[model samples]
Target: MPRLMAFDYGTKRIGIAVTDPLQIIATGLETVHPKDVIDYVKKYLLAEPVERFVVGEPKQMDGTESQSAQHVRGFVTLLKKNFPAIPVDMADERFTSKMASAAMLAGGLKKSDRKNKALVDTVSAVIILQTYMETRKF
Candidate 1:
């Protein structure tokens, strides 16, 4: 079975996570510069069989599309264009960053580590992947 990959796209960096072949567990893969995301995914595809892509969809408190929605939509378009074989899906990501920060605090991470936005992004990607996995009927 092929794995499922998830992305938390941001202006400065993109966080990545992947599910197990059985789609059971979601694990944080890496955080890459926004400009390097395509190359990174290409290299990763050469090594791993990813069947699907999940991207976090940012929305405002009122459940409306946020400013970052356009950026994520563009990123999704690029993914669809580059990896036509893989289907890209979106999941609501209203409080993922806050959740990630809470997780880091609970994990007892150092202050410096907690201050890293990239770390938060990576964790958010993992959360997104896990959320997608749990929602699957099979």
Candidate 2:
């Protein structure tokens, strides 16, 4: 079965997550440099069947689009232009980074480890995917 992929987009890096083939669990896949994300997804597609994409929709506390959202939408446009078959959706991403940090602390990560942006990105992607999944019917 095809799986769903999620991305937490940032200016410098993008965190990725993918569901199991059964679509039962979402797992953190990797953190890729912004420039390398397209190539990375291309390579990943060779091994996994991805049916759809879930991108974090950056929003401010005031319910306005965040400045970074433009960059994310740009990425989504490029993604659609490259892979016209797959559908893309966006999920609210407010507080995901803070949630990731709290999760890391609860997971007993060391102070140094908790400070790793890459790790936070990956965890944030997982949270996004999981939240998206929770809203789905299946």
Candidate 3:
């Protein structure tokens, strides 16, 4: 079965995650620079079948779209234009970074390790994918 892929998009890095073929678990895949993300994804698709994409939708405390959302929208547009078949959905990203940090702490990561922004981004993508999957449970 095709897997579900999720990305935590940032100005510098895009963190990617993928679900198991059974769609039961979400795993961190990679973090790529924004300029290389499309090519990275293209190469990934050549190796694995992805059915849909989940993008983190940045929002403010008042539930309004965050400024960074515009950037995400642009990326989504390019994504659709590049891969017309895969569908893309956005999930609210509030508190994901904090959640990622808390998870890493709970997992016993050292303070220095937990401070790795790239790892945090990847973990945030995993959290996004997991939340999306939970909401869609049958």
Candidate 4:
């Protein structure tokens, strides 16, 4: 069975996560630079078959598009063009960062470790993936 992949996208870094073949749990895969994201995913696809893609969609408190949404949308467009066969969907990513932080703290990471943005991004991607699986708001 093909796994499901999720991304927590940023201008600088793109956090990636994937589920097992059973799609039971999401695991942080890697945090890659934006310039290398597509190629990185392609490389990963060579090893693992991914059936679906989930992206964390940024939104404002009032349910409007956040400034980051435009950038994410651009990435999404490129993603769809590159892999039209796989379906892509978005989940509301309002408090994922905060949740990631809390998760890191609860997970007993050191202060310096918790400050790592890459780890935070990866955790956020995991959170996004979990949210997608639970609610599937798309």
Q: How accurate is candidate 3 locally (lDDT)?
A: 0.95
lDDT (C-alpha, whole model) for all candidates = 0.93, 0.95, 0.95, 0.94
Report, for all candidates in order, the number of backbone clashes.
0, 0, 0, 0
TM-score of 2: 0.97
Full ranking by lDDT? 3, 2, 4, 1
* Model 2 agreement with the true structure over 20-133: per-residue lDDT tens digits: 998889999999999999999999999999999999999999989999988999999989998899999999999999999999999999999999999999999999999999
Tens digit per residue, CA lDDT, model 3, 13-126: 998999999999999999999999999999999999999999999999999999999999999998999999999999998999999999999999999999999999999999
Candidate 4 residue runs with Cα over 4 Å from true position? none
Candidate 4 or 2, higher lDDT: 2
Give lDDT tens digits, candidate 4, residues 1-138.
Answer: 899999999999999999989888999999999999999999999999999999999999999999999999999998999999999999888999999999999999999999999999999999999888988644
lDDT (C-alpha) at residue 65 in model 2? 99
- Per-residue alpha-carbon lDDT of candidate 1 for residues 2-110, written as tens digits (9 for 90 to 100): 9999999999999999998888899999999988999999999999899999999999999999999999999999999999989999998889999999999999999
Q: 115, model 2: CA deviation in Å?
A: 0.4
Best by TM-score: 3
Local error of candidate 4 at residue 124 (angstroms): 0.2
* Better model by lDDT: candidate 3 vs candidate 4: 3
**Error in Å for residue 37 of model 3:** 0.5
State the displacement of the C-alpha of residue 59, model 1, in Å, after optimal TM-score superposition: 0.5
